[model samples]
Target: MDSPTILLTNDDGIDSPGIRALANGLSDVGEVTVVAPADNKSAVGRATSSEARVHEHELGYALEGTPVDCVIAGIEALGPSPDVVVAGVNQGANLGMYVLGRSGTVSAAVEAAYFGVPAIATSLYLPGDRWKTVPKPEEYDEAVRATRYLIERGLDNGLFELADYLNVNAPAPENGRTEMRITRPSSVYDMTANHDGETVTLQDNIWQLMERDSYSEGERTDRQAIVEGVISVSPLAAPHSTEHHDALDDLAAEY
Candidate 1:
């Protein structure tokens, strides 16, 4: 293909600095058309709306819905279908297997996979106070660079043929260039509920582990890689699989 058409969307809203940096970084790589949420819709995984409203923007277009809505609108209601769907450069990292259904960033890529279009979902891993502070555009340099590199060089090399989509998480770059490592989502789960009177608060204790450097080491997992300041790239498939068991077969035979 001469110039690939890239469909860009995010849960952080169209005006977010992350998406803006992403669009600017990939501008030279292909024709990018933006169809993103009108306001921050973070963590609303794969949600769709029948009453979505679309409006033109200088960046491209804004959807009064979730990132998933943006993807469907871009593919069906907008103009031409895109060659690839790119999501995020998300405000926060989407790590661990448990987070897949809870992350709008990754969900956008998953939605694209159902349509048979290759996609990449990107995010930055910020620890502690960093999450509360808004990052400047320059802080996104590493993520933008890695994202462009993947689209321009990695995609054509059959990266998409094997995996339905990729979840890329990066830490802030150290000198100039950053290091990337292939990894799987860490199987860490730390959810709890605290009850006081009539109210209950849900919490994920993993944050405390992260703050304490208590996450198990070894760079084989996305959570580990992010903790070590490396970019984590996890190749993911879309299908929900089932395992064959002899007990099920025996039960079926009896029935």
Candidate 2:
């Protein structure tokens, strides 16, 4: 395809360094239009708004809505119909299977899949110690490089035929380089909640768990790949899977 148009978005807002890095990195390969949130909209999943406000940005547009809204707007009204949708260079990784529905980054890509547009969701893995600090745009280099490679070759390489989009997680570039690996969302989940007298505190301990090497599914899983400083690319479909069940059929018959 001739200079494929790329619709770029993210949960971290249009002005985020991660998205800027991605836009700059992918510019030569394709025309990148960034239609992202005006402010941080992280972890909003596939939420949509009947009316979302939009304004112009240097790269493209910034919408006062969720990531999914950006994808929809980009494809429908904002710019040329994109050849592919790219989300993130997210501040944090969207890894395990459980977090998929809660991640605006991945959800944007999923929304694109429903429209039959191939997408790629990319993120950087921040270790537990670095959660308090802001990452530089250059820190996203490895992730952006990986995303650029996929955008350049994915459409022509039969990758989209296999799945709707790809979920990629790259180790922070400062950690040095590692081989890219094809992987799956990890099955592990780590969430804890504490109830106080009048308050409930919820925490996602997956990053902490990772720091201690408390869990490992090895190379086959996204989290494990990031832990080992490897770039992970997992091809996945958008629609939820379904299967016939005799038990459900029998229950329906009795009802």
Task: Specify the highest-lDDT model's number.
Answer: 2
lDDT of 1 at 175: 24
lDDT of 2 by residue, 137-183 (tens): 77988899899888888899899999899999998676646689999
Output the lDDT of residue 23, model 1: 93
Give the residue spans of candidate 2 off by over 4 A.
none
Query: Please, what are the lDDT tens digits per residue for candidate 1 over residues 146-234?
Result: 88877887668898898999999988544223888989988889899999999999987876687565667567999888877888899
lDDT scores in order: 0.86, 0.90
Model 1 bad stretches (over 4 Å): 173-177, 252-255
What C-alpha root-mean-square deviation, in Å, does candidate 2 show against the real structure? Answer: 1.3
Worst ten in a row by lDDT for model 1 = 171-180
